[model samples]
Target: MSPKKLFARSAAMIALTTASFSTFAEEVNIYSFRQAFLIEPIMEKFTEQTGIKVNILFANKGLIERVKREGELSPADVVLTTDISRLVSLTSQDLTQPIQSEKLNSNIPSQYRDPENQWFALTTRVRNIYSSSERIGPVDITYQDLAKPEFKGKICTRSGKHPYNVSLVASVIAHEGEANAKVWLESVKANLARKPQGNDRAQVKAVKDGLCDYALGNNYYLGKMLADPKQVSWAEAVNINFPNQNTTGSHVNVSGVVLTKYAPNKANAIKLIEFLSDDVAQQMYAEVNYEYPVKVSVQPSKLVASWGQFKADTLPLAEIAKQHQAAVKLLDEVKFDL
Candidate 1:
């Protein structure tokens, strides 16, 4: 073969390989505690924009422990969590790295992100009160108000140790002192219609079944139930009430993300996180999952909006997270589940 022909062939092969790499640059592996359906769309959009595929491993528990066990060899690029405490837990374990991204910083409000930039809340869910339509009329209630004498034997909830309830309880500890929060938990526990059992939707169902008149549950579960054909009736029997609008604002928890300590594809992972915080992804979070966007510019879904607005507590997530152990201990102290 001639020298010119060989040189030309080599250049063509090099260009082809480079273009192939550019076309599918990398894949970002996510260890997500969030349900697959809730976040898959946002990830699809990220891939569409950046050409970086997302690989998600979704589970109900133990993702953080898995990451810790894997250590530096962990393939996780980002850890996606449905609650603020896990994000803080991942950070506390030194399993995540601080990211300094202006895009991330600007997109997520300071109130909804880590002071050190280790975790960025993509969306927020309100732990709302579901009141029986037949028993309770349009009523204004607060989280603190539920513990009053009149509400005894009127509340339904899941196991108090569940992350959702713990986060809410932790928020209480944040807003009030630990002693006051403990007393309040005891009062609320005394109000339970039965021993704490079932998921959030069951609490709503319990209201419909007349098992209880008021249930503690996350606001988004109402949307989940509304979409389920069989559970639609259970959903219709309750009114979504964002409690504490009159005081310290509604107790809100976050679904957040962290940059893992062993992110092999760090650049691609950062792009995915940036995409999630952008206006488009924020809109998807509200529309797809009925959660509030962390971005101030993005509006909540119409259904979520129709529930009307409530002031979201601005307490830093870290503050609430710090109280998680105390919340759990108090639940055990009160035997809230029993």
Candidate 2:
């Protein structure tokens, strides 16, 4: 035990200890299709409250395979996606775990969550019509009215295969019956002001360009357009309408999250999801994304509130996921090119 040998041993011990301490630091890994900036505040809040660092991999594509490839080695504790169909796909593939959070169960409405707790809807958005403020005067329009001959060649929408469109069409099927919904879809297809092409915001732009008098858009798109300083003119050109309020109300969709089946940090993941379901986080979700908080007690953003309240189709959103294949087939039959 000479001085040089003792010094070497001490250094080796210190290195090993540092590595061990680093491994022990609390962390939760999340794979989210939602943009990093959009969910940063929530992530920060979770970290601040629980002192657990969240490592997020944010990508819109290839995340599913990445998770599958990672398999038992996957570090992802939770996944956040925008639609029920996508959530269902993940669960069907056995990539997600059933989360049993009482807070989530109590806060989220049954209509907004999976029956088996495989996923939970965090926020909701309605698929409603956006009309040109100057060209279209104040008038009520129903999803049914979109098929009217008077509106032919005056409507715009995104591609039919899109989950939003699929779910929207599914709601029609649930409400109007398949045969009637198919007939309505065909009629609406004939009315396309322009070939289905672009995201919801683009539909608004088309309306601005006078390519069409009206467009189908989700409520959040209107919120994003209105919030964008550069898109102020685009915002000015259109007015929001919650269709069929006096009848069946407007179509709605959700942003939901699920725990990974092999989550290494189940406790932390449960805490994170529960935190998101609570009032403060729910309010942040509504204000930041301009979406309706799933929590009934949480009010919509001021901009959303201004649009006024409307009934939303209560078809178990799981049905939208279940009927997604049928919706896609119908969209194809109707020839919605996007």
Candidate 3:
């Protein structure tokens, strides 16, 4: 089904469900770019504990546009999405309202949230470099190393336009400045094993199949690949290396939430957002989605924990967001994907 049709159907279903409930039953509506499966369990637990009916419309894209079209009449209380870009889009478009919650402030670290509290990160994942176990074994590397002559024709990645890669490029711009980052991007383009193609997991599969010696992928994909029976070999064939450990450390990104500006159930929405930031929901995010919890008190699932800790770049996410446009322009300048 088209995303629009699917969104309409899902919204209708949610409306019916909400209407069937007792009139007094509190409810909150969500427009989410996140997959339903990853969040349903946590929502169910929240419903059980608070008796607030949760209505969700899940789409891979267009939630932001949909909310914009709905404007003041929008039923959406919250917007849930992955990546810093989407989170920034919410505030940039003026679709979200600032939230003031002591619980949220204490649970999420400053670096992971909007300074204005318009959005709060729920989970974080590292942008890791996966090295072929059979070819390269374990090695310490940095984003800068990917551009070196020694690694030419040895790396694989997704499209430069992909949010994950774009964010990585943006981070380079954030740390190295546009001129240096452009040069690095040009050299990295020269090093591509093939034109950048496929998702992060596909890059790992490329490494496993010996298409390349290295792949840039998110950290959670390794945990996910290990759990999938068909992909365990891909997981086994690579070592998850944290880049820039000796310097600025690995770049990290987040999945986050925003309260809509015209929420009909503001109180319940705040309650739900607070619940998501708390230990119970944060733990579910870690265990169920293979993501690292933003809540400092919550530890990662056992499998994710086994991948020893590493230093994450201290560059604020807002700093990375600032470089997004420059990063995209640099990618185009280098013709990185073509």
Candidate 4:
């Protein structure tokens, strides 16, 4: 089916063919946490290069639960999700199985792929600090700096429990240990311009609206906001800062994929995974999603490169994943979002 036609059917159109059942021989079913718009062009390119058909079911939640419920009957040949924590959760749930592909191993960095090969990060994004161009001027900062008395009532962030913040917090725990991370979390909360209350873009808008001087956000959202007519001013109002360049490097996250535990179209799924890991598709993933490709050979988009590249935190994401619960509890303990 054409990309337009595939999109027209949407999630309602995905056929639930079990491993024991059959739908289309050359087709693969994707259970994606990512929106269809982001993947359609890449899927189109995949189809153009290979005769394989891609069917998608896009969901914001419950994909893992659904897969588990379906057991071997699940039609999901692949699962694509954002955030290492979600990938870790899926692996812990046993919804995914390992894929030992040389192409995947060669293309994706070891730090971004599961040690067990259950999931591979397709692209990366940095958690960044957006400084007001007018008020802040040039700035040098770190994740730890957000806690200082100088920044009190000057920082804007979303809920501390949100995955992005949690991941950063988890990294702090990984680096500083639980006790120091607790103190840091409290200090960060003490610095909030207002109660933690919105998404990453909202933090940027807070900077624009003069509600705050420093906002915590993702680097790619700068690209997204710049491209959005309504959000362009927000992007313009702040200078994107890749934090911790002088320290341990900025925290990085990924949008990744996994082969399902019982992928009916295993061959096609592997082909899809390999396609995404290569330069062409990695480029597509970077440009389309405003993210950094996990493949070392693929360059980030011009807009992203304009943000000034820095060393991504080399801490294995798995280590951060392990501290997620501790980070979330720290958020609750600090009442960071309250």
Q: Rank the candidates by lDDT, best first.
A: 3, 4, 1, 2
**Residue 290 in model 4: shift from native, Å?**
1.5
**What C-alpha lDDT does candidate 4 achieve relative to the native structure?**
0.87
Error of 1 at 302 (Å): 0.9
Candidate 4 stretches greater than 4 Å from native: 1-22
Off by over 4 Å in 1: 1-25
Query: Cα RMSD for candidate 1?
Result: 7.5
Q: What is the lDDT of residue 320 in candidate 2?
A: 67
Clashing pairs for model 3 are none
lDDT by residue (tens digit), candidate 3, 1-338: 47875565456445543223111339988888888889888899999999998877778988899889877667788999999999998899999999999999999999999999999999999999999999999999999999999998899999999999999999999888899999999999999999888898899999999899999999989988998999999999999999999999999999999999978789999999999999999999999889999999899999999888889898889889989999889888888889
lDDT (Cα) of model 3: 0.90
Computed on alpha carbons, the lDDT of every model, listed in order, comes to 0.86, 0.83, 0.90, 0.87
| Weakest lDDT window of 10 consecutive positions for candidate 1 | 15-24
TM-score (C-alpha) between model 3 and the true structure = 0.93
Better of 2 and 3 by lDDT: 3
Best by the lDDT measure: 3
lDDT of 2 at 275: 90
Candidate 4 residue lDDT tens string, 93-117: 9889899899999998898999889
Q: Candidate 2: list runs displaced more than 4 Å.
A: 1-25
Candidate 3 Cα deviation (angstroms), residue 36? 1.5
Give per-residue CA lDDT, model 1, range 1-338, as digits (tens): 37875454445324432122111247887877888787888888887887788877777888898789767656678988888888899999999999999999898888889999999999989999999998895578999888999998889999999999999999999889899999999999877789999999999999999999999899888888998999999999999988888888888898999999968678888988998899988998898888899998899999988999788888887888889999999998988887
